[model samples]
Target: MAFDNFYYCVLYEKKYSDYFLYQCILLWMCRKTKSSVTEQQPDSSAIHTISTLPDTNQYLYDFLKMVLADQKLQYSYGLSQEVKNCLYVESDEVYLSRFIITPPQTNPYDQNPSGVDSTKLIYNTDSSVSVNISAQLILNTLTLLPNHACLKKSDITYMMAEKSRLHNLKWNNQKTGFSLTNKNNWYTFSLPYFSKDKKKAFICIQSLCPGLCGSGDVLLYQFKNNKWTSQKVDSWLH
Candidate 1:
């Protein structure tokens, strides 16, 4: 019931009585609570199976191989670290809008800054060559993407879903108390946001190990001459 109607019932109406008012108030409260929960939940489209998209399956397969072999990443591994063996990947697809770069638009003088690298994913650096992929297009969940089964090409363990991954982490924490990295390292991947023509795409991959071992990167991949070339758009480490 509307607030105004509730007030009218309280201040003016007497035939319907306090029981009716209480019922109306309870329904309103229940609706408000439900709406709040819905807003806090993640996008439902992100939790579907990716087996339907054959091309996306192959693309992810190739991209993962490229990432694992990256020399720079291999060098970052400490004596106790490794990417192969018991690696656990998240089963759902994530969206890239969280990692989008948003620059200040108040400065007129800074509008046309020179020396900006076009190859990089700098937002508002140069309008002509700017990476202007649409949010709607990139958020397409229909793109046959990667899942636990598709990621089986690698010699690693893939968690069935986020719930399973979290349960394992919690069980490990209780058993070893964050002191051991054994089977605790995990990786999460975002569904690749493709450009309008499907020749370019952006994806985010995050890895978390026990203690201070963790890192994430937003990568840009361009398909050229039947091969995909990747470059770093942004990254973080801990």
Candidate 2:
């Protein structure tokens, strides 16, 4: 008999025009299995779960190769290599893959870099395949300076709210967040040594914008005399 179902998870990171965009897509073949019992009666024996299936890494790799063969994407070499590196199979019949693309050269005087055209292709398995795609900005890792400490989550939330208010930017206290992992949109904050006495320190907040294509920001703050004060710092976006 044919395979009952299939699941695919695709993730990729691309840097273009000084913006890093990461995307994840989950695809599944959605169909009900035929059972010997009547439609009105449930058949427990006919039900099969993903965990019962064997490892599907080879199948997923083959599928990806076939899918990429039909597409006309710029940087196909780099993307295909990355895809090969990221493809893996999970225990739950899930295929997860991620890849990153870096530009070959960044010289304004030289030739203009080739831009990748977006291509969409329909993948066929046993029946019809369902696709779901999610994209987010890439979060960079920040190494804390010596004698530095990270601010508490509550403090960061409050600081972000005040900053948004003063800067006239729309921010939600509940949604504005931070994380050790770069899965979602959040800012990670650390306090660097600011004074010789080490009592006062500069708050360094690093974050990526919410959308797929946006710049990252590093906000600095100083705590003195029982008040938190913002400070100006030179930041570069690339």
Which predicted model would earn the best TM-score?
1
Query: Each prediction's TM-score against the native?
Result: 0.31, 0.20
Flag regions of model 2 displaced more than 4 Å: 1-184, 209-220
| Every candidate's lDDT | 0.48, 0.31
lDDT of 2 by residue, 1-238 (tens): 1332222111222233224322211111112323323465755664555446664333333332322232221221111111111111221112101111223434333232442223345576555545433222234356454222333434434433433333422222222221324444443322222333323333233333445532222233445696544433324332
Worst window of 10 by summed lDDT in candidate 1: 148-157
lDDT of 1 at 133: 31
- State the lDDT at 77 in candidate 2: 16
Instruction: Write out the backbone clash pairs for model 2.
Output: none
Q: How close is candidate 2 to the true structure, as a TM-score?
A: 0.20
RMSD, every candidate, angstroms: 24.8, 38.1
